[model samples]
Target: MKTKNNIRVGISIGDINGIGGEITLKAFEDSRMLEFCTPVIFASNKVIAFQKKHFGLEVNYNGVHEASQAVEGKVNIVNISKNAPKIEFGKETEEAGKYAFLSLKVAVEALKNNEVDVLVTAPINKHNIQSEEFRFPGHTDYLAKELNGEALMFMVTEDLKVGLMTDHIAVKDVSENITRNLILKKAAKIHDSLIRDFRIRKPKIAVLGINPHSGDNGVIGTEDDTVLKPAVAELFEKGIMAFGPYSADSFFGSDSYKKFDAVLAAYHDQGLIPFKTLSFGKGVNYTAGLDKVRTSPDHGTAYEIAGKGVADYQSFKEAVFTAIQIYRNREEYEELTSNPLKKASGNNR
Candidate 1:
């Protein structure tokens, strides 16, 4: 099934000091991976060499100038800057953060210019990567700004899909941020993603409550009734199949998340804690409602295992698979919508 129009995946080397290099190398170690798509990594040749040696990887990569020249069965590294920062494993430093941003910045530019079909970013330390130029909370926020679109942090896997409306924000401000308008916007984005990217034409979404037991009918709090219920009604009026201000605890407890296409949580840990708990090494963090495809591993930089070659690459591999699937699904969805009789198909992405 390999074709000339294989989707190109651009990968960003995360923290030079972390396991980004390890997992990335491991993910592409199999030559069969190239059968699906060509991969372009944004990192200096010197840095990649260090990572390969340090991790004792057997895979070989070709240092290419641009994404267009990427070769199948060969890892292509788009060397960003002739020189790169020093690698200091198990330690957080400014240089690690700088090069991490550099790799991401270069890969993002390639994606924006249509040189790459999708972006698969590695993990970066949110604290260390913060600079005056890059001030966003994480990849989702930064890409949302650069790409000029709202991003829903959609965590995906074979089993379930969960979206966080309030991500990377403090818990104290969670209640104040759950406005009706914000709910509607996130709901719309989720709907669009399910239809276009996931190929679910008539998708049903479940929304979780902000407070305990959905405010227990105003005993625990009032926002669940005052904000969430009305927001769900408004979304229903707009023809979106959104339900609940469901209780955070009981929803996942009873395995009710299995009943919907996607679940939108009021806050970060309210959803991710359970998602990660269930699908830790297999989850793909996808940024939906964007002009281009972007995904990352559900986990973060594990400095303790940096350069050890023991990091599990399953999540990173799933990220690449998910990005490619989304890109293809979006293309097919557009094709079908553009021509009704062309192909009324069900997706396997």
Candidate 2:
């Protein structure tokens, strides 16, 4: 029901020792970005100054103590910490992890309170960020819990959209996690996101197999045949347009994914490897089915080149753009659904 001309994007400056700050600043280097959206980075002024000095950057940001005090047309730094820990590039310390959690926690709180429209998170070191405060595997789980919604790790790009059924779990646990209900839930989220977030009508979803050759007609494994096949059939019966437990190995190689609107992979690597391989620098990881918009770059914290100022920001930029677009799409969808004439007009066009 609420709408705005300029989207307020809340950003969580990920690991202070990593390339998160570098990429966040680089994404806003082009002043043209501020024309559409205002970025509020949940970080301390000390950390920003340290990184700026290290990179020799001369960017201007509005340093505010609260989210409501954020200014448009500039990077808004919401100071979560007074005296930031010392700068230690290319190093993983407890302090870096602590700040990373603080940044994410504050940004998410702002998002929950509707202080911002969407969230674009920077790269976080999984190992370092694991403290008593944040015990989840990654951002997806934390965001899901905070927003009171399920998270589908949706890898989005111009070429394709891939969603994982199981995320951040080990190989041993993947099989146990792949249940009929899990598949159905992820497929529904991806399907709903296609229509609501991406504005796709009549989405055709492709399902990837858990085993090689879709379990080779039950000669290898029966999960794909027994579990996945029935799940796809159920989805199709509900008018979801879902198909196949196709062999993961050959599906991408054959370029068959071009025919579908989105693909549901059985596990993490089964989906991400191919998605990242195709759109390594440009892909955006959208957490679909969340009440609020949240997205991240496909890549992680580049500790090797933390202070080199060479980390690619294309993916981060795309994540920001994707969050804005999804918010707009959601608003438009609500407007159309509320009015019969507008809904009819939209369908006709």
Candidate 3:
């Protein structure tokens, strides 16, 4: 497939009414983003203007109704709306949710149409984005359902890479969702993603035990032995390099996580607690296994700090860079796979 551009990135404005727009503008303040790829914003010019004015950001916007009008030096807006909702910092009204959802929809459509190479989403409010039209717990679940259930949420930091077997679920109901199929599926997605996106030839994945001490041989909890163990065994049979039903507590302390490319957790807090503690302001939330690349900051819409212009862009920066790296790696992988290798010349010599 011949793309019109080398790498056109589609950025979705998560919640214009919140700090999503501010940090997005801050991210674009680094003009070097143009060096990597063309970026198109799936947001209304009005929203961008409000954010720029409200937060005193200096970035310029060029309203483009389509991707064809995208150009460097200015933030290219797809102009999903000309007269969208006004800026109301820290608000979670339905209008904000609707706008955020529309932005994501446009970005996803652009990716599907090959108009963009990768996607980097800003933080969005889960409760506000869960209405009749945009009823989803979070971006991960929303994207997974939209992409025919192909995405898995993975938290990535410089030190730790974690995957939640279940994301955005109730703490009480986590055990009910911990079936062998679910565990294996999340593991397979993470494994394939490590190889295909991260370029890991052989991914070593660690599966965390749902109970303490990995159930102490079924003395603490049977799920760790019966459910997690069976899934790990199945993954091993499929030639996937995976291990454990490890005690979550010791898994991180022993520096055992250093040995694997990624760790699979049974639930949301199981994985995120450690990840966030280590990288509260710098973690990248990546949705792996999607046909197109997508990433976001691990944090949410900081309503308290809205319009303060103090929100750190480190996570956002990491996400954008990570997305670019993944896109390039996948592109390279496809190129190599499609071409044939040459035979050695030693015999002829």
For each candidate in turn, the TM-score is 0.96, 0.97, 0.93
Ranking by TM-score: 2, 1, 3
Q: Give one clash count per candidate, in the order shown.
A: 0, 0, 0
Candidate 3: tens digits of C-alpha lDDT, residues 1-349: 4343346778999987677888888988777766766778888877778777777777866889887678855668899976688677877788888888889888888877777778899988887777666677888777777665487999987567899898888988988889999988899999988878887778899999988898999898799888999889999999998899889997887889899899999888889888888786789999998887899988888988887889998888788888888888888678766663521232244
TM-score, cand. 2 vs. native? 0.97
Off by over 4 Å in 1: 1-5, 343-349
What would the per-residue lDDT of candidate 2 be over residues 83-191, giving only the tens digit for each residue?
7887788999988888899999999999999888899999888998997878999999998889967888999997799999998999888877899999999999999
Worst 10 residues of 2 by lDDT: 1-10
RMSD of each: 2.3, 1.3, 3.0
The true-versus-predicted C-alpha distance at residue 217 of model 3, in Å, is 1.7
Poorly placed runs, candidate 2 (over 4 Å): 1-5
Instruction: Give the better candidate number (1 or 2) by TM-score.
Output: 2
Worst 10 residues of 3 by lDDT: 340-349
